[model samples]
Target: SKTVSTILVTGGSSGIGKCIAIECYRQGAFITLVARNEEKLLQAKKEVEKCAINDKQVVLCISVDVSSDYSQVESVIKQAQEKLGPVDMLVNCAGTSMSGKFEEVEVDRFKKLMEVNYLGSVYPTRAVITTMKERRMGRIMFVSSQAGQIGLFGYTAYSPSKFALRGLAESLQMEIKPYNIYVTVAYPPDTDTPGLAEENKTKPLETRLISETSGVCQPEQVAKIVVRDAIVTMGLFRTIALFYLGSFDSIVRRCMIQREQSKAADKRE
Candidate 1:
């Protein structure tokens, strides 16, 4: 029932972001996909236009590195607003995995995850929230992971960033409630995406073993449910997928993470 005439999806060239962009077009939302890869963005734009229900709902692609600075993200948001009108929806989906023990992983790897995963979500939300607040309507969704809800082994650089996202969304939900803006944070199961496939190969054997123990869902499937929940129910159904993730405490604590190094050890364990 909710209508998003103009939407922005970060990391829209691949994985869940690309699928979300396509689904938004199917639902009649004009989309601007932001990512660093111009070639992929162009290809994704074509695919979205092909599935678009309303040709009038324009699909635009802008190349921007979400992991960089806030200023870059803000500029992209400003451009999207001027070109496509105010952003009715914002989806934060750009992220990467760094596999290794926390001590073995480089500091830069952790920093990269924080910038792209946590700050990637933060910068865009900051850029658009003012307008959404002024207009008194908007939808903000974060494509967090099941690992974020629980924890995954060898997710040294990845899990903290996603966990940070949950904290960010929880705080923002209360702050934005008065403005009639909705914030939905999703924790999807391991998704079958190119990125995940690559990680499965390069990551240590332990990482692959742990991933098999849990189920993996298709990106398109997760995207469909995410879009349906974000648009139709707003923030009401945010924790549904994440709730099941909480059941794996042992996996979160013993196999996946170092017991001595855990941050939210008591809460998750």
Candidate 2:
């Protein structure tokens, strides 16, 4: 069966989410935007409408907290599928952060970060996986971070959540390969988004230093490249040029060493 014209994006109300939603709309893909804030979702819908070349449909904003649970995510997905038809693609962008030394960060904050960043993708993937599997076709992309690719100081809470997502994508890719469900994990350089700017102000100096050193790519630039990659990739880590994979491996090793040293010092103190 030819896929439907719609794509679903979580966290689509703002930042890179909003940018990608707009880009997809401009490319004539009908979009279903999922986010927690109704007002922000409406604003995103307006932006998508402005960019849309086809008046076929502007965009459908489904206010949803994708992290809550399977039932909640499934309910939203059902509504979107009913209204927009089968979702041809899903971009899991809903995420949150809890930055502080691990000891300074509260347990609740850590759990909240994990719920929103990791389980946010899990719940929605659970909702859509069966259908995509049955159809044997779909595209799923994750807006992971350089933190996931290479941990910086004080991402104690945030890094683990994104790292879990990378692992999830790796596992799911293998499982879905035979079904032709492509999965791409994107590692965007720090992007100048409203959320990112807010994070910059509060981030620990060490974390800020790393971000300052690594050029902050614009949201539009990351969005366009990610969309293009999503369209072109086959499945899993395969289509990602091997050099990046090798580079990612090296970074992960270095990060692990740094984390070990930090943990040891904390234990001694």
The global C-alpha lDDT for each of the candidates, from Candidate 1 onward, is: 0.83, 0.83
Q: Give me the overall lDDT of model 2.
A: 0.83
lDDT of 1: 0.83
Candidate 2, residues 185-261, lDDT tens digits: the string is 88887888888877776687877777788888888889999999999866556645668665665665577568779
Q: Pick the candidate with the highest TM-score.
A: 2
TM-score of 1: 0.84
| Candidate 1 residue-wise lDDT, 50-146, digit = tens | 9977547788888887878889889878988998899989999988866777788887888888998999889889999999988989999998887
True-structure Cα RMSD, model 2: 12.3
Model 2: number of clashes?
Answer: 0
Count of backbone clashes, every candidate in sequence: 1, 0
Report the Cα RMSD per candidate. 11.6, 12.3
Q: Residue 224: error of model 2 in Å?
A: 0.4
